[model samples]
Target: MAATVTPENPRTSPTISRSVTHTVNGSHKFVIQGYSLAKGMGVGKHIASDLFAVGGYHWAIYFYPDGKNPEDNSTYVSVFIALANDGSDVRALFELTLVDQSGHGKHKVHSHFDRSLESGPYTLKYKGSMWGYKRFFRRSLLESSDFLKNDCLKINCTVGVVVSAIENLQLHSINVTESDIGSHFGALLDNMEGSDVTFNVAGEKFPAHKLVLAARSPEFRSKFFDGLDVEQQEIIVTDLDTKVFKALLHFIYRDTLTEEVDEVSSTTSSDFLISETLTAKLLAAADKYGLERLRMMCESRLCKDICVNSVSIILTLADSCHATELKSVCLKFAAENLAAVMMSEGFESMKENCPRLQSEILMTIAGCEVDSCSAGEKSQSVWAQLSDGGDDAE
Candidate 1:
């Protein structure tokens, strides 16, 4: 039997462990000629600076005219410094400075320096890893600020690669800092630094870190490692809408839907909110990406919005997205309120775009009528038999 420690007896041992870690620092200055012309080059598109050597590695800078995130909608300019050579598990710190063109000496700077962090230096898993900002500065603001002058802009990037080894040293039970990994990762995502992947959806581009995505979603892990090319930096996503793809990325990075952006509702014409349609699309994207929790979240929100005006549309989406719970709710709701649903604009759309859904709706109503045969079966049969026969709507 193992012995248990008592108040009178304590376990004690000599601690002599040491970690040898330090950073090799370097800086690169990049000048952009014709900064004015670089505007509107397209979202996710970049003006690349010449490669520079730093800390035994090669690095380069990228400037995005229309912002790096699709959801930002071209409202800001983006800048990021990236590792150019193939590497794995390279850890580092970075600082980016946007030079003030005027003599005011008020330059904009984003840095991970001279501050105590809950976590150590960030780790980059592979090449093409980047660090910077998706919205470094607002477009109109930057255009008018002292940073841009004479059609040129100057920027500086500093990299400090973290090195580590084992060494002999004294150790003690030191008090650790409070947990802040979420905020650290959140900072990484918002800072857009050390991102290694670019996902293009419908013309909008989003930059993200690969290991983060792979760790969060199994589907992403498979896409990155199992069969696909690991070094494929840019991925084109054609099926999902730009907004849908952005929300997916948000959930992948942070594990929650961000409340920063809002959309115009297609169904209600509401201003600045997460609309039902967007949620439904998000549910589909989440399912596709194998983000089950996010899918459930979207499905839950969509569940509360079901009504006669939206049931058919919701039902069709649920069917396609394979959201069994949401689909069951929608089908039952549609069958119980068949008259109101048929008169709805959503029902008409279902008839046109998804004839199988029309059949499914009819069949669901027929099933309900069968259970309630005493509630006039012949009359319900007339409506149930009205379903069109066609492609997979059922």
Candidate 2:
């Protein structure tokens, strides 16, 4: 049997809500220049205007001078609204009106609303299909009325598009514990079973899989498979300690550093701190192997652990590795604690090793001092002030 324990203060689940709605209207005016002549010459003859877009679909207005059906030929004029694009099953409302040009505002309207008042808008299933009255108006009556003016007839079509609202629900549940696959890989690394390649780092040998190393590091890939001889098995790694190399391999196999670093600190000593020294070395190694994510992780840890004792060394390391964000953090920290930092040996090391970074530090300190001084206060050079305070008691 397994034991289960509940927390004293259980967290509540979070809720999320969403809603959206949109409507678009497009109007097209179709003009017939010689209305009397066109009506006299046509039965089963129609004219189509240029295609237009509305609500992400193409449409056109079709005008038949004579009635579309032979039953109503020479008696009524027909008009229709058509879908022109390759769209399927589009639901929309349509209105076709013959404008009364005499300014009486007595326009004739034929709409989907008049036919289906209880139901909803009409659905268009395919292209080249239409919806309207075949016998829209009597040809003689329309010609005599204000609908035809100066031998021209104007027809207006309005389409009102309704975009349906979309709603989504997201449940925010409590944190549930789960198994970590990285721990299993870490266990495999610890066991060192079925190893194919050996790396000798500062006189300590580390056995690792060639495939795993190549997958993790491009430098390892080229050295192991592209450039080096196939029979070459042993690689000697210099300028890096056994601990740092072990941590790098641990990251390659396990994809994490938390457990590996913790285990290393425990084995070495309870008081052994995971110092900026180790992190800086790891960051350098990560950059060399093109492990950008690992480099960023190391930079994040180093940024949080910045202090008076470690800021200078970390700043130099950041400059060397081209870690821009970490470099900015270090510069700010150093400028704030300039007096104490300048007295440290790490600062002296930076001054000797990276003069360009030293110049950047001076500029940052000057900028900070300039920002602090108000317009009423007398301006003093930051370097002059720092020089005068050298070796002075805090």
Candidate 3:
């Protein structure tokens, strides 16, 4: 056997080949309103979901209300996923879910994720190629189920395209997460390992780094300019409330509102969710420090709190703080509910101290097309008071 061996040609370079297939996945929800009305739309007629893309190909969900095949009568409804573009030989996995509206989390699902296919992923040979059931659900059973709520039905679809790339001896891939520099800075504030300055605010003190404070606020930067004498300088703040100053420091370091500053949203809470007095004070501090973002945040939070009870007080704050957007919202809200607002204690307080605001309210209710100052009226003109004394003089 050794004597009968033939010589073979030798190759110069080493090479490797690999073909990897994976799916690019996406999900879409399609809601059918007036479900009962759609029930009689004849056989083979389908309602399609809005086109959504996955793996650079267009797809849609088609729902047959009165069954796809006439032989099955109207007993069942059909669901299918069809290739929406003019592509050929596409492979995919499909899943259909009927959401339960009863809040019991009992969703009806037919999924490819849990099943094993012997021949692999389903292939769509042409543009109209589809994969689904002719009898997706029994019509009678589905109509009476918790899947239908308020004459509406919701269907969720998941599609996975099996045409991804292959990698051979590729370099390592790294997943970069979202930036969390604020939290680290926040931790630095908490530990106070090398705190250089202290703020004495209303008999309470907060120790913080001078550089961080200077970077966050121009007012703090101006204070630190020209170099200081003391290594750990203690600055006295007389005007701010203790809690307000604390919250302001937290905002300066953390770039977020404290737990005391709740979003005063009607959707989140029926009553004013934010500590109104505390946040108003915070806004004043933000304005004084040239923190525009923090000032706007405070304005936005307070705007959601506008109602008859708080509108007058909020409007006064808005005018004083120069929160134009919040002021506009408060004025509109107050004008729309003038009667209720006038009956509130906050409104009476506004009438006594903020007569200018009362005049602005009247202008808003009168549908004044221009600003009072620009409408040929002096900026400092005293507004007329409608009183019984005028009639007595007559």
Best candidate (score: lDDT) = 3
Candidate 3: which stretches are off by over 4 Å? 1-173, 226-232, 262-276, 366-371, 374-394
Writing each residue's lDDT as its tens digit, candidate 3 over 54-89 gives 878899889999989899646898999899998878
Candidate 1 pairs with clashing backbones:
130-194, 131-193, 131-194, 132-193, 356-393, 356-394, 357-393
TM-score for each of the candidates:
0.45, 0.45, 0.50
Which lDDT value does model 1 have at 229? 58
| Model 1 regions lying over 4 Å from their true place | 1-181, 201-205, 260-276, 366-394
lDDT of 1 by residue, 1-394 (tens): 9778887877776657678888999998888878878787888899888788877889998888889878854798889989999888888888889999898989999887654275567777788998788888888988888999898899989889987888766564477897777677777888889999888888777889989998988888998989565999999988887877777877876677867333333356231122345776788888788888888887787777676687777777887888888888888888777877788777887888877666566667566433344445443465545543323365
Ranking by lDDT: 3, 1, 2
Per-residue alpha-carbon lDDT of candidate 2 for residues 284-366, written as tens digits (9 for 90 to 100): 99889999888988888777666666677778888888787899999988887788878777778777887666656766866
Q: On lDDT, who's better, 1 or 3?
A: 3
> Which candidate tops TM-score?
3
Models, CA RMSD each:
23.3, 29.9, 12.3
